[model samples]
Every structure is written in structure tokens, then in C-alpha cells.
Target: MDMRRTGAIEAVSDGGTVESIATKMGNSIDQNKTLQKTYMLVNLASVHAADESRKIGRKNIASQQNEIKS
Candidate 1:
């Protein structure tokens, strides 16, 4: 269902109390912020993993060059 319609349904379910609606809205916002922070952490982890992989690859390449010289 559309969000607006679902929200209206929720409001109705809560007996249309302003405080109840505002509290629900606040909870939703908090959940969204939590989700956003989680997404950022995952993105940062991916970047760090990629950087570590590059470092490993560079080390391998340098080792191979030393082996060739020897």
C-alpha cells in the first residue's frame, strides 16, 4: 500500500491521537537514521577491504620481481 495510505491507517489504528502519531513518526525517523548509519559502515568496510586487497597485490608483485632478479 502507498505510504500515505498506510500512515492514515496507522493513525486510525492509534485512535488518532496527536501524541501517538508523533511518537510513531519519531520512531520511524530513528529507525531510518540507524539504517543509514549501517549503510555507511558497510560502505566504509568495503573500501577498507579493497584497499587491503590492493596492498596485498602490490606486495605480491614486488616479491615476484625480486624472485625474477634472483
Candidate 2:
């Protein structure tokens, strides 16, 4: 084969490799963003649950105090 043909083949191969690497990197970045969002949602849910628990405890304490007064 001629040198020009060999060079063309090499160029095409390199382009494919670069494109594949870029695609993989993009996918990895997307995955990281998704994971971060999921973690944030989980944290928010935990905080909400804690708030609800505190509210219930306060209500129970108020009930007990009223009972003692009665």
C-alpha cells in the first residue's frame, strides 16, 4: 500500500479513538451530575423527616402537659 493510504487509515483510526474518549467522558460527567442530584434529594428527605419527628414530639409533650393540668 502507498504511504498516503496508510496515513489516511491512521488518521481515521485516531479520530475514532478521540471521539470514543470524548463520548465516554461526557457520559461519566452526566452520571456524576445525576448522582449528585440524587444525593441532594436524599439529604433533603432526611431533613424533612427529622423536622416531622420533632413536630410530633412537641405535640406529645404538649398533650402530656395538658393531661397533668387536668
Candidate 3:
């Protein structure tokens, strides 16, 4: 929150209008929310990918035992 307020102060110091600064802050918040959602989705995808890889690499002990009986 302080970081955002400080950014607004900097924006105003750089001659931005109050309305534009407020809009920029709102846009930043929305962008952060979107980025957070994307971050979570990426983490979820990675976890699922890892699970699938593990499944693919797993050996079937029953199949191996049956083959040995042949």
C-alpha cells in the first residue's frame, strides 16, 4: 500500500494529473491481480505435468511378474 501511494506521489511529481494517477494505480492493481492468477495457473500446470511424468515413468510390477512366468 505504501509502495503504491509512493508511486502515486512520484507520478504526480512527474506532472501527471490526479485522475490519471488514480487510473494508473487502478490499472496496476488489476494487472497485479491478473499476474497473480497467471502465476497460480503456471504453478498448477507444472505440478500436473510433474505428476504425469511420474506416471509415465512408473513400472507395472504385475505386468513384469506375468511376463517372467511366460
Candidate 4:
């Protein structure tokens, strides 16, 4: 979405008249579905990163506990 907004603005400005501007804007909005998918993928990646971090943290805590026991 952020990437699209920047590109859309440039496209609209380059077109410069009412009809051309509207056409560019409409095209930009239509392209938003791709951006939506990209956003979803990024969120999924973040969830994976967090899950991995939690597993690592738990393992480290267990290792510390074992060291203390010895």
C-alpha cells in the first residue's frame, strides 16, 4: 500500500488532466489487491519470527536451569 501510494501519485501527476488522472487513480486502486496479499505475507512472516524467538527463549531458559542444577 505504501509503495503503491508513492507510485500512484507519480502516475497521476504525470498524467495531469481530469480523465487521465482518474484513469491512473482507478488503476492504482485496482492494483491494491496485490498490495493486500503482500501485506498478509509480511504479517505471516512476522508471526513466524515471533514463534521462533519464543522457542529459542524457552530453550535458553531450560539450558540455564540445567546449568544451575549441575
Task: Give each model's whole-structure lDDT.
Answer: 0.55, 0.50, 0.56, 0.56
Task: Tell me how candidate 4 scores on lDDT.
Answer: 0.56
lDDT of 3 by residue, 1-70 (tens): 6676556556545666555754766654334655334322334457679988777666566568779999
Q: Find the number of clashing residue pairs for candidate 2.
A: 0
In terms of TM-score, how similar is model 2 to the real structure?
0.40
Show the colliding residue pairs in model 1: none
Give the runs in model 2 whose Cα sits over 4 Å from its true position. 1-42
Q: lDDT: which is higher, 1 or 2? A: 1
* Cα lDDT of model 1 by residue, 1-70, tens digit: 2564356445545456444544655544334555334322334457679989999999999999999999
